[model samples]
Target: MASLIEDYALLSDLRTGALVSESGSVDWLCFPRFDSDAAFTALLGDSEHGRWLLAPEGAVDDCEPQHPARRSERRRAARAAGEEDPLQGEAEPDPAAEGRPVVVQRTYVDSTFVLRTLWKTPDGQALVTDFMPVGDRRASIVRRVEGLAGSVRMHQEISFRFGDGAVVPWVRRHEDQKSGDTSIVAVAGPDAVVLHGDRLPQGHDHRHIGDFIVSAGEAVDFELCWFPSHRHVPARIDAGASLQETVSYWKNWSKDIPQQESYHAVVKRSLLVLRALTHEATGGIVAAPTTSLPEDFCGERNWDYRFCWLRDAALTLEAMMTHGYEKEALNWRDWLLRAVAGDPDDLQIMYGVGGERRLPERNLDHLPGYEGSLPVRAGNGAVDQYQGDVVGEVLVALEKLRNMGGVEDHFSWPLQKKLLGYVEEHIDDKDHGIWEMRGDQKHFTHSRVMMWAAFDRGVRAVREHQLDGDAARWEELRDRLREEIMEHGYSEKEGTFTQTYDDAEVDASLLVIAQVGFIEYDDPKMLGTVARLERDLMDDAGLLLRYRTSSGKDGLSGAEHPFLACSFWLVEQYARSGRIDDARKLMDQLVGYSNGLGLLAEEYDTVDGRMAGNFPQAFSHLTLIRAADAINGHGQRAI
Candidate 1:
């Protein structure tokens, strides 16, 4: 089985990403683009489905008395030879099989996508550096292993199941025309991957396996490149040069991130995670890399998040814009215009990385889900749902970009006007809220608030910025929305805002009311809502849940853990309300929830003390950045 979700690190080429476990296994990866069929799908199944594992080769059972006896015998033999003693050398032990401690530590090489994992055993240490070459049209993943001390026997195994584990490729050995080195090529239909290294693994049982040893100071390099099967295999590039170029590219991009001294390290890493999830050419940022990692483990709540959600990407743009990344904002804005270019009536909640639509949700019966969260789904069905907050999110992000001195071009302003027109047409409709609930559509309070924000921004664009729009109508709707929400969305009996206009259920999303300028952070109504959320939705650890599953509002069975983003939103609210100590305390706890490499998932199982849901989620990280800014006195947003 694969390791826990938190035990993985991500490597990205700006188009796609590879999720590598701490023990050095590329268990999940989509080729060519973020929405492409996964070439390695072991994250959703066993190694036989698809995986690339490079781990130590032996058992290290310390409980065995024979180990001490053997060590003593080896020491005696060395002493008898009259030579200086050397440290005990053995193959790296498999922790699961050996019942021994195998400490695996990972971190990104500062401000870069290059990931380094060090495996330390009782006998020796080995370092595996993983990265994907950016600015290269050909999709490729590169891994280099180095021996730090003592000789360590390493096992390399690879299995390819193209098309999300639906197709097993025909594998064959071929000599590269340019380098004359033996490489293994796997071809299935139109997709193919060529594995090149100093010593390529030989095929066995429709798989590939290689065992090698690296003594102190020795190193080895491996590269996997993806291309169409019909096309000639891409010529190999210098791994050393690619490494340098990829590092330089990331460092240069990260140079502009403003420093937050207290949370500088985490802030920088969070920014990098967001960048890794973004498609360079399309500028669409995915919600997360691997999908079907359940929000409720062993439950059927798992949904594929590889496609780009406009709401998540828009919030990502706002986070970046706040931190001095306007170029990304403009790029994503352009992608948004192209993606929703047709009729405003046809705009989707999400799109493929290159702006392709028509993502039909279906089950992959062949591969088991992460932790047996069965019915592993792909292509989110949420695309068809009407999420009223989406245009609001986009408009809010563009407004922030404009605030940061971004000039609106002819295309962007026209797109905003069209979006406002769509809002006008859909004003009376009930639709799915920001959570993309599967339940029957209702006038979700959060969605209503966002619709208000949408018109607010639209009115501001015309009245404040001298842009083209019906300012009077937008202002009228904005005021009318506020009135509607105040009258129907809040409950005097409950002394707080309700989840929907028809019910009094408190939702974590209601925390954003203050964030969208709908109310003051310390407003008595917001305070009452916060109290209700804390009483009803907060876990034992002070973390916030999205809402009560017991309410059945989401139309789903099974309970979920607390959402990290919601907790961060609470922290932001606390900070802005002058609860500085409370904000800092909660911020510290939330930051501590990140994995060893400073990455967070969509949700966290505080009871299990592990990350849950999709790995390296953009929502979690983006909110983390905003929360940190708030705690550091930079998050005083004017309502």
Candidate 2:
């Protein structure tokens, strides 16, 4: 079985990423592009589905103590004292951990995705450093094993399965003429990878396995590169130099962020995650690197998030802009111009990394999902959904870019006008809400508010930026929308805004009303909405759910855990509305939900106390940045 979602940390080369577990297994990886078919799909299935693992032969969880006499005694003492068990709510200890090499420690080399893990066996100790070279050199991963204390027995396994683990790749072993080092190549159709290492594994039934011993002062290097099956093998890279370059690249990129007073380390780490999720060649920001990680485990709530959602990309841009990352913001702006260029009417909610449309969602039935959550899927069906709030998110993010002194050219202004024109044409249409609900389309209140925000931005551009547009017409539409929302979207009986015009139920998206400048964060009506949200959305663990899945509004079976991004939205609301204490308290609790590496998933499963849904979620991290900014009073003003 795969490790818990929180146990995985991301390693990115800016083009694509790999998920390395605490056990030193690269279980999920998509090469060449963010939207490409995964080369390692063990995250959704088993090692047979494809994985690369390098660890001691008998590796075990470090937390499971080898000498259990003192551990049992301490546990008994704590239980007798009536103190809560430290392992309460945790999964039962895996019996399989016995007799395995113990991991002493694992952490990213500070400020970089370069991973370092220390392992200890009865005989010796060893250290492993894993990282992806920062530059996009056809996607590569370099892992180095160095003996630290004594001679340690190490095992390595590589199972190359392409086409999302459906293909059994052909492997060939050859000796390098120049250096006489062993090299292995795995080929499947057009995808091929060359593996270079001092201690290469032997191929067996489409799997590569090896066992070796490393003594103190000895080191070994393994580098894997993915390329075209028809092309010549890529040249070798010096692992040490590449590592230094990768470290320097990340440090230099992050050095310029404005000095943060609060959540300083976490803010920087979240920003790096955003940077990691973005495609280097194109400015498209992916929602997450992995697909088919369940939201409602063992259920059908799993959906692919590898594609770039307009709202997510826009929010990511805003987060970057807040910290003065204009170059990246402008790149996303250009990508938007290219993506939605042809027709204002043909805009999509999401797109492929290269701005390619026509994402067809399909399930890979061959592979069982994460923890047996079946129907592991690829692509996103929501791409075709008409999410009315998307352009508002874009407009809001772009406006932030403008406020940050981003020069708007003719193309940029004209494109905004076209988007506004499209909104004007479809202002009265009923469609999917921000959640991309699969149920019947309704006049979602959040969507309507975003419509109002769209016009408000147009008026702002014309008035504030001295840009060319119909300010008078936009102001009229903006006022009319505000009136419409108050009259129809809110329920006087419920004392709060409804999820849709037809229902009295509140939605978490309502929290963004003040964020888009539609209402004051502390207005009694808005506060009433917040109160309703607190009562309805707060789960057992004090985290916020997106909505009551029992309501059948989303047209999905099975319930989901609390949404991480929604909790952050509430934190932003708290910080902005003069509820600083509430904001700080909630913010600290929400941050606690993140893994040791400061990475968050799409949702938090309170029952299991584990992160659920897609790992390293862009929405979760971006909102974290926004919430932190609001807490520090660095959020200039909600766009």
Candidate 3:
């Protein structure tokens, strides 16, 4: 089984990424691009499907166990083992045997994304490090191995099962004339993979096997590149130079991030992970790199999030822009325009990385879901839902772009007008709201607030940026929205705004009403909503749940964990409202939820003390950046 979601770290080429466990197993990865078929699906299935592991070879023997249930047995075992190190063991075992130790430990080089894994053997140590060039457009993964101690034998395995490990490609080998080295190539359908390294393994059928001994100080490098299967052949490049370039690129990109005095290291690392999740060429940032990671064990609420949602991408861009990454913000704005172009009626709440539509949701019954969560789904069904807040998010991003002095092109102002016109026409229609609830639609208070924001920002664009738009009409609609929301959405008896006009339930998303400038942070109503959220929605650890699942509005069984982004929004609200001490307390607790690598997931189950949803979520990281910036006096900048 794979480790917990929080026990994994992220590595990417800025187009796609892989989730590597702390135990040095790359359990999930999409090749070539973010939306491409995954080559390693072990994160959602068994390891036999696909995975790349380089870790210490050991059996769980003796230790000062952390879990209370195992402590007594662990103590007894520790006394029996005396002083022996638990990790020392043999490398090879029966392939069909159970309880075998494979990959073991992983970490990144300080201030860089280069990941190193250590595998132990009875003889010595084997090390593998993986990294990618930060700003490069090409999709590349580089792996290097070294021997640190006594002579240790290592095994190399390669599998080319693509499309969630269902498509096995034809494999071939070619010898390089200049270097006298061989490289393996796998071609199937639209994808082709080329592997280059020293001492290339000999192949029989679709399998390859090799054994090499590495003494102290010995090093070897391996490089893999994916391309279109129709491409003639891949050219050779210097692996050493590629490694150096990748390191230099990441270091330079890391330097561009603004430094913070408090939680400096943690904040910088989260920022880098966020940058890695962004699509370099298209500027569409994925919500998370992998999908179908369940939010609750044995629950069927799993949905794919690899595609780009307008709201998530916009907020991600805002976070990056606020941290001095203006280029990413501009690129995302351009990508947004291209994605939402054409008939206003056809505008989707989410899109593929290249703005491709037709994202029909489907299930892969062949592969079991993470932790046995059934109905492993792909391609979000929420694409067709009417999310009223999407246009508001886009308008907010456009406003931020203009505020940052980004030049509005010929298509930008007209596109903004068209979107605003659509919002003007459909602002009253109650659809799915921001949560994409499959249940009945109601007048969600947060969605209404965002509608007001859309019109408000639209009017400001016309007035300040000198853009052409119906300024007077937008202003009137904005005021009307405010009036309607106050009339129906507010619950006087509860002293707070309700989730929707029909229900008096408090939602964590209500915290954003103040954060997004829909209302003053210190306003009595906003303060009341904040207090209600803290009392009703927050778990014991101070993390905020998405909503009261007991209300049965989400159309799913079994409650989900607290959403980290919502918690961060609360932190921002508290800080902006002059509750600095409360804000700092919550901030510390939220930041402490990060894994040892300083990466966060989509949600954290406070009661169970486990991470839920997808790993290295962009929303969580963006909110962390936003909250940190607010507490640091940077304030929320328009992006």
Q: Which runs of model 2 end up more than 4 angstroms from their true locations?
A: 60-99, 634-636
Clashes of 1: 0
How many clashing pairs in candidate 2? Answer: 3
Q: What is the lDDT of residue 41 in candidate 3?
A: 84
Off by over 4 Å in 1: 59-101, 121-123
How close is each model in CA RMSD to the real structure?
8.4, 4.6, 5.9
**Model 1 TM-score on a 0 to 1 scale:** 0.93
The numbered model that scores best in lDDT is 2
| Predicted candidate 3 versus true structure: per-residue lDDT over 1-639, tens digit per residue | 566787777888888998876655677878878888888787887665566654434422212243221332333355467854333363323312553433446678766778877766667777788876455455667778888889766666555668887777788887767667678888878888788877566775555656677778998777777778887556655666776777787788888676786667777887788788888889888999888887776688788989999999888877777777888888888888898889998889999989988888999887877767888887899998998888888888778878888898998888888988888788879878788898887888988888889999988988988888789999999999998989899988889999998578988878778766888888999999998988999887778888988999988788788889998998888878888788888999999899878898889867456788887888898899878877886344223
Each prediction's Cα lDDT score?
0.86, 0.88, 0.78
Candidate with maximal TM-score = 2
Query: What is the per-residue lDDT of model 1 for residues 1-639, given as tens digits with 9 covering 90 to 100?
Result: 667788788899999999987767899999988888999998898787788988776522223434432343345456668865533465533464654325566778878989987876556788888999999776999989898988777889999779898898999888877678888889999999999897578888978999888777988899999998889988777898999999999999999788776788898899999999999999899999878998887789998999889999999988888788889988998899899998999988999888988999999999877767888988888999998888898899989988788899878889889999998899989998999999999999999999999999998888788888789999999999999999999999999999999687889999999998999888999999999998999899999999998988789999899999999999999988888898889989999988888889999988557788998899999999888888887447833
Supply every candidate's count of residue pairs whose N, Cα or C atoms clash at under 3 angstroms.
0, 3, 3
Name the better of 2 and 3 by lDDT: 2
